[model samples]
Every structure is written in structure tokens, then in C-alpha cells.
Target: MNIKDYLESGTLEAFVLGSASAAEADELQQLKVKHPEIGYALDAIEADLEMIAQHMAIMPPPGMLERIEDRIHELKRHPVAERLPDQLRDHGQRSEKDKGQYIEVEGASSHMRIHKIWRWIFAAVFILGKIFLGFAIYFYLENRQAREEVKELKREIRQHHTIIGQQ
Candidate 1:
């Protein structure tokens, strides 16, 4: 196999991009060892890809890294176990009988608090729903009355036709 043709076949690029099949990767590894030119070509392709990645990389916001580091430090100082309530932390000390017992938790307030704007929006939606329901009922009654009038007119027309036929 021509090394030049093999290098130009894009196998190196596929391998570097992690898209090469296992067999193709194994062949590449063997070829890379036997031929210095294949290794050089692979290295060049990798360097080119790295350059492209560096050029396309986006810079994070200024304080983003510092904020992430600070968060990590805070978590390290307080750990998850330290943050748990005293009752929850004493689980291991409880006997088998006490293990089956449930822990009672108390909250400061039973009511949920939402944004003030959301309350007004919900009230508006409720009023609009009532208005739509009233319109629906009104239209339904009107349609029923219209149907009754149509039936009465048809009956009268039938009777007039019958009387004329008799004459």
C-alpha cells in the first residue's frame, strides 16, 4: 500500500476526529509505527485541528471562573452531610424499632408565595374564562330559539300547502 495514498485517503483525519473504526484505528497504529511519514502526517493533522479549535473557542464572562471557584470552595467548607438537619444526621444512632418511625418536618409557612404580577395575571385569566363561558351560554340559548322558530315556520308552510291541495 502506498503510504502517500493512505495518508491522502483521510484515514488520519478520521482517526484524529475519533470517527475511525477499530480495525482502521489498529491499522493506523501499525502503519504509524512502521512509517515515520504517516506519524508526521497524523501529527500535522492534529495540530491543524487544535489550531481550528483554538480559533473557534469562546471566552467566558470575566467573573464566571472566579464565581465557579468560589462556589466550589464554599461547597468544600460546608459539605452535604454538614448541611443536613440534626434529626436527619442522627439516623445511624436510631434502633431498629425507631428506624421504622417517620420523621416529622415543620415549615415556617404552609402557604406558597408567588410573584405579585402572577396573581394579577391569574385573576385576569379567571375573569376572561367567565366572560367566555357567559358568551357560550348566551349563543347556545340563541341557537336553540332560532331552531324552534325554523321548525314552526316549516310546519306552517306544510299546513298551507295541504289546505291549497284540498281546495
Candidate 2:
């Protein structure tokens, strides 16, 4: 295929992704042997992807990498079976009490008693958990995206180098 046809078919992107089938790889290999231009195109595509990969890498969330590593180890040690059909419980029931009632979702035992300190403590924990979770997600995404951006920048630099060398 001509350059336009080749690029239009999305084969280059797949090749860059290393997602091309074995048949496609063999064909491309043959093309590379027959034409220097094809090799140059492949190099350019690789350069672009290399840039993307570089840009996507950034510092991961604090303790997240360690936690992930630990989880992997745990998985290896004990393979877990997938459990389906989550536990269903009635939420409509209410215990007759004073003006307000508190119910424990799931625990060994639960009893309602008025206590200002316990309410504040629960609220504080909830808020902190939300903040921690939010930052963890944001950090991971930013780190990954930064790696891709760096890769793109490097690819542009390489392109410039190629052009200047040609000149």
C-alpha cells in the first residue's frame, strides 16, 4: 500500500502498539526488507510511541505502589474465588427508640445510644477517607498522563533531529 493507504488503514498505530497479528507482522517484515522507506516509517512510529510511553510515566501515589505490590503477593499466596450474589438485607425496618435511631450496616452487634462525640468521629473519618481516595486516583492518573506527555515531547525532538540531519 502507498503511504496514504498505509496510514489510513490504522496499521501503523497497531504496529506501534505491538497489537498487529502475526500474519501482519510477517508482511510488514517483508515490506521492511523490500523498502527502506517502510523501515523509516516504522522507526518514526516507534519514536512516537516511545515518546508517549515516556510521557505517561510519573511518580505514583504515596504508598500505592507498595500497596499494589503487597496485593500482588497476597494474590499469589492465596488465589481468591469470585463470589457472586451480594448479601441482601432489609433496610426498611426501624427499631423503636427516641427521636432518632442509628443502625449498623453489618457487624457483630449494634445498639443505638445518643453520643455527640461518636457522631463527630464518624463524620471526620468519612470526610478523610473521601479526600484520601480522591487524591489517590488523581495522583495515579496524573502520573500516567505525564509519562505519555514526556514520550510525545521526545518524539517531537527526534523528528526535529531527523529533519535537521536530512537538511
Q: Which candidate is the best by lDDT?
A: 1
In model 1, the clashing pairs are none
Q: How many backbone clashes does candidate 1 have?
A: 0
Residue 75, model 1: lDDT of 72
Task: Give the per-residue lDDT digits (tens) of candidate 1, residues 72-103.
Answer: 87678668787665556986577666666776
**Deviation (Å) of 151 in candidate 2:** 84
What C-alpha lDDT values do all the predictions have?
0.86, 0.72
**What 10-residue stretch in candidate 2 is worst by lDDT?**
81-90
lDDT of 2 at 73: 65
Residue 65 of model 2 has an lDDT of 81
Which runs in model 2 stand beyond 4 Å of their true positions? 1-11, 18-26, 56-58, 80-167
Tens digits of per-residue lDDT for model 2, 1-167: 68558656777678768899988888878877877777788788889888988989887779888878876866665454311112213234443541254333442224343676998999999999999999999999999999999999999999999999999
In model 1, the runs with Cα more than 4 Å from the true position are 78-167
| Candidate 2 RMSD to the correct structure | 34.1
